[model samples]
Target chain A: MTDSSQVYVREVGPRDGLQHEQTWLDTADKLNWIEQLGEAGLTYIEITSFVSPSWIPALADADEVARTLKKSPGVTYAALVPNRKGLERALLANIDEVAIFLSASETHNQKNINADTESALARLSRVAEEARQSGKAVRGYLSMAFGCPYEGKVEVDEVERLAERLFEMGVTELSLGDTIGIAGPKQIEAVISRLGRMIPLERLALHPHNTYGTGLANIYAAFQLGIRRFDGSTGGIGGCPYARGASGNVATEDLVYLMQTLGAKTGNDLVRLTSSAQWIEKRLGRPLPSSQLQLSKEEGRCL
Target chain B: MTDSSQVYVREVGPRDGLQHEQTWLDTADKLNWIEQLGEAGLTYIEITSFVSPSWIPALADADEVARTLKKSPGVTYAALVPNRKGLERALLANIDEVAIFLSASETHNQKNINADTESALARLSRVAEEARQSGKAVRGYLSMAFGCPYEGKVEVDEVERLAERLFEMGVTELSLGDTIGIAGPKQIEAVISRLGRMIPLERLALHPHNTYGTGLANIYAAFQLGIRRFDGSTGGIGGCPYARGASGNVATEDLVYLMQTLGAKTGNDLVRLTSSAQWIEKRLGRPLPSSQLQLSKEEGRCL
Candidate 1:
């Protein structure tokens, strides 16, 4: 087993965060933020999503964002691809990895993607095969794996079934998302315990939102259960699509601060990350929802 | 060992929270909120502090608050008393329990109370004896037990020694406070492991601030280590007196939501507690910092 002392942090601000913003960030600005994230020693940066712009207008320049960003040699630049068409676009943009997402609940999957759970899985299976053949890494996101705002209390068996299928489809990693941020410590432990038995812990990642303020608690629980990789937005800019007016992804600064404080080797610089978060928040003309960023900005110090 | 499935929550919003607010809540309103908290099934509430108005003008009406609030049969109402004078005031107000506080670090103690650590301990020792003789349950708070804002990392041995001293001084419970909220999982585990050897876990409680957003994480860590009791503010209205521009104590709504989600029987109604939080926030004219309150208000649903 890999030691829990090291954590892999994946930054998903550009795709998950900006997509929820009402004001559109220019492609150049998105690329600038991506470059800043890479410079801060983030090994994985989900640059943008190649989904239809009609579905998420804020990320209309996804192709431009993926093509224009400066990629660090050590950083893996990723993009979210909703379908085979999006996968083709990601390949054209020279993305290092493509993430495909489907919610575990039938209602959530239908509401989010306009497809049922089985249809979404079949579609993702084909996309994963195509991406693998292109020599690109594939990541599967099981959104609402913990609970769904629409359905509520997704079962662990459902998550295991979906995750096993994704793994079989050649996904290098499976990101279990608490899409609405309703998961607590015991719920996280139960889900991870069941999933860990069927999937390798190294290939399992946690993607928790902070809507109900249980994000860090759930993350800590998962870490104790041997989950090492985590996905976070730089400034908690994203939103839970199902739970309107709730928070976005857990803040990258908060996650990095917690991991680093616990002696977990993240290889990310807290000061530099905070600076980047401040820079982006300034551009957005609104404060990010990150508690650590707010504290660092107010105190003029970093973790 | 006690079952980890049960959690005892201590609500300190009236004392810890209101004292930090710039706008004062009327004594009647404070009593109303306390009544609501008790109605929601909270068994313990720290009603008010017996500090002088010169120090914390917000709680100047503490006597009225403690005397006017309706004490439920099953609920234990507590008060914070800094010295023998404060302890006398608490007894005069008919408080069931009196809490005495001193920081684990000399600098924090000096800054917060105008006394060195040893002198503050000596003063608290006297107050603890008086309160115990009065047949009042006494709780000792060691502030900055996890880390200090000025001194930085506080040694665990220092915390253990202070906790041992407090226990020996007739304190029924010793609340270890992460006053600055800089503690992480490993640090919490290390401190709790060392403290658990000398003090019974039942006599130990966690009082963590959310300054760096690690409050819930620390609470979960302590809970896993068999520390069942936790202290929280209703609306996250309290501030770390030492850590400038930081968040207050972990929100009671957030903590209750987490414990309930984990199947820990707190016996508190989250909906009723959130209603009280909303009522207080409305009076303050600004939103409280509790993320759970925000979600509950936005979603119009409580855990």
Candidate 2:
């Protein structure tokens, strides 16, 4: 039987998904969504990114969004930071944690960050050192961990090396991201099974994309492999122009629905999640990518 | 390691999918789709039904469709028969096997066949007997086995009893049809595992709807329970018109993509599946529910 307690879902739509939206999220609106997510029992919400405004205009107000969040007692609010500069900005916002992301694929790394995979790793080491000195928790994200959109299939060893280097650099946890939504169940299990042997289960969180409609399947695969933490979007609103029509992330309501149905304790209120998902989908004036929210609405399944 | 070679994909789009279409497929169009499916290496294709044309005008030319099949050497062509009259029609047709469907829920059975579940099972008994005595293999279809659109969440005992009765009625195999798409992975596993203990692995097939977007997830859950056979439509069409659609059958292209990516041998070409799906979709003037087919076509995937 699958254990019910091991899955921990994190809503990353505000940081990962919203960062891709063309419309600028007002500071109050961003705070309202963050608070709503926290009240909906989302323990971890990636609040915003501390990246340069020129790179991600939607999140240019990351500091204000971070500062204005009505925090829950145990909720962890994480901020995405590219390097020491971004890290310094995030620390000033007094966020709960900071996440460092780098592309594992050489092509994506060069095109995305103007650095090869190794050079990105070297930068992460310096960032991790600064975070350690500041007494702040550093989390690492290995983008394109399962496969690369540009390069097709990725070597498992390449991902393992990146994970090992991040761990060696003193990052507390690693979130393996299928940036292009291409990881199927077998691939998710293959990567987790291989990585589980190298890193402790507690140190791994899975971030999957819904490009091939296997996002939840991949999450379940990781759950079966003893990984607990995962990442999702609220309405699945974020689309990466860079990823080229690829979906941003799995929908939060959909993820929670699958988990709750599978007997996993996410402590998430399905009704509020639906509202939050619907609220944002309305904000975007588009249909949400979440099957649960949409189906629940149709079936009148509200709390 | 899971032996991908053991998986058998049964293409049922022509019979199960097209039977309920509002826009009746032209005789030539059905033949062309079947031929393309055969050339794509699909070993089992449910060509058409021998049911009364008065009831289902969409499949009015079922007899001719069966007679004009390409007849690949090892391929299996099965026809659906609703009663003794339908079975008699199939017995005369040059078809290989006969299929009979019964609803697992009383309300669904009543709505579908104008009889309750018991009466439907009783009728299926005579249909199975007639097909058996004629030296043709009898396959039982247990519709609404998972969840009924009319009566929500069917009892497992109710389904098991019906399935057991059908098996005892000279029916060698059972295809569990989720009439509505409300069933999830856990529900699929719970029933499949309970039934698997009593029924042989090779004797089971799963039919799921994309209503809650659990079609692919249900496929994996069944796969975990050792079920290799599944029913799907080419573009994922047909639904309970009375129920106002809980989506329809899972898309054949999506199913093929899932099975192939999970290392299961379907022998069906993804490229060809997309082309055939697209061709019919254009003719129908409505989008087929095959996500991968749409994605692949938009991205210029070709055989």
Candidate 3:
């Protein structure tokens, strides 16, 4: 990004990355990767969520992972906190930002927090407001905002109403979630255009899964629409804990590759990113769910 | 499409789909699939190729497969023919159309056909002229027109020049290739926009491989630009043989999914298409690569 108005990539490996890790990441390895990502020039990093340990045992050392890292001066670290209990734990970690997630789909909300959409929104609003009182910036994640694999097509009005309510509740930003990676450019345009009317562009971020492998293309659509913040995972970490057969979050390396090519400023080394991804691939006992990572490693192959 | 314009979907599974399979399809299975796809309202079914048996013995049953099927009256059964030898063989079969392929990159052309771009063009032109003289509509396959796996970024002028030359060679239509599948919407626009300027949109089509999984999105861009004809395989069948690690062609069912969702008309039945995909998936010992196929089988999922 040569322009002063550049995009920021929020690295979600620490939280989204380890959530689905079959093999628990040793605290040392977690801290090591966190430190590396910090040095790699990520302006925003999501360290870990303060969700229940039983739900995500992989992130049990969330507080330790947060405290062990040497903070990159200008970088902000955020964590996902479900409600008051999760927020208390995140507050103890002294994180710069916290995120509250609520679903646009009623079923997802019912399953997510065991509350209906209305109740989930009320609880999320309270959490965001209370977190604001403590002077911590809160981001509201509206999951299944585009289309849920569970519920099929989610209404844009439902997404917009929730986003407006979140913004009113003192949340710093609204991140639209395409949980199952079913969104395309047209859908992105439709949802974002509607949300852009309801919410401020600066207050909007996007979290797109690469399930259908359209993550990068969807990001381009958002970029064209002047969206400057996006959520990505290192090595495409973090499979959906709730959704079955869903792809991981958009690969950080692929995001960087597309952004850098399209003139978005992200100070990530392609070679190092691919190597780190390869390391994660080995740990996961599978190929990285990143087309860019695989394409990069095929040495001497022209494309 | 609500417009008077119509889109033609060419099924390339028989030729492109089975080319990489080591397991030679039962001649009966091949014939059954061709018949099934024809019933699905495919306008142009690429039945088989007349390549050397030594190179692609999996498709050695092409002659038998072509002669045995019940040809749908309005549907064109096209065959891939690389040179004079392949063309002669295809002409002897029940082939309604013959497609000649020439690579855009000199390196790809040399590696793929042991001929440079010019020589390969000359050979294809000669074959196209011969097929036209025999009253067969000749479709030209311009491989790697977007990007070559063997030679990175292909030039638009070169692609446009070759496409124009192919038109002059008595070709019926052109299918621009995304052989390596590195193309995004902007690149798709650049190619079609340039080609649309040189040649009429009526004679243009897109043949995208899903290596990077942007095939559907690229197809969306193509449709948006008023270029309707496309090539896809059942169950996302074939990958570029030379481009190791690259993905197979986009699945016909998945393409139909995108087209139908956009409110375009296609004569394919999703349920039956899904079943056919599953049948091939069992034979290939892998799940179908189409996103919609997997999503469909999941109890709660929909695309």
Q: Pick the candidate with the highest TM-score.
A: 1
Using lDDT as the yardstick, the better of models 1 and 2 is: 1
- Stretches > 4 Å off in candidate 1: A1-4, A240-245, A299-303, B1-4, B240-246, B299-303
TM-score of 2: 0.89
Could you say which candidate leads in lDDT?
1
Interface RMSD values for the candidates, listed in order? 5.1, 6.6, 4.6
Per-prediction tally of clashes: 2, 0, 2
- Tens digit of per-residue lDDT, candidate 2, span A1-303: 545485788789899988767666688888988889998998888999999999889898988888877889989999898988998888888888889997778888998888888888888889889888888888889988888867889899989888898899898889999987777788888888898897888889998877666776677778767787888888766655433333458888877877776777888888898899877877766555566654655532210
Q: In model 1 chain B, where is the ten-residue run with the lowest total lDDT?
A: B294-303
Cα RMSD to the true fold for all candidates: 2.5, 3.8, 3.1
Q: Rank the candidates by TM-score, best first.
A: 1, 3, 2
In candidate 3, which residue pairs clash?
A: A1-A264, A1-A265
Between candidates 1 and 3, name the one with more favorable lDDT: 1
Clashing pairs in 2: none
lDDT of 3 by residue, B1-303 (tens): 235345678899888888877566788888888888877777789988888888789888777777777888888898998888888878788589998888889898888778888888788878888888888889998889988766688899889888888889988789898877778777888899998886878788899987765677678778878888888988888854444344578888878877765667777776777677777777767544665555555554322
lDDT of 3 at B72: 80
lDDT of 1 at B280: 89
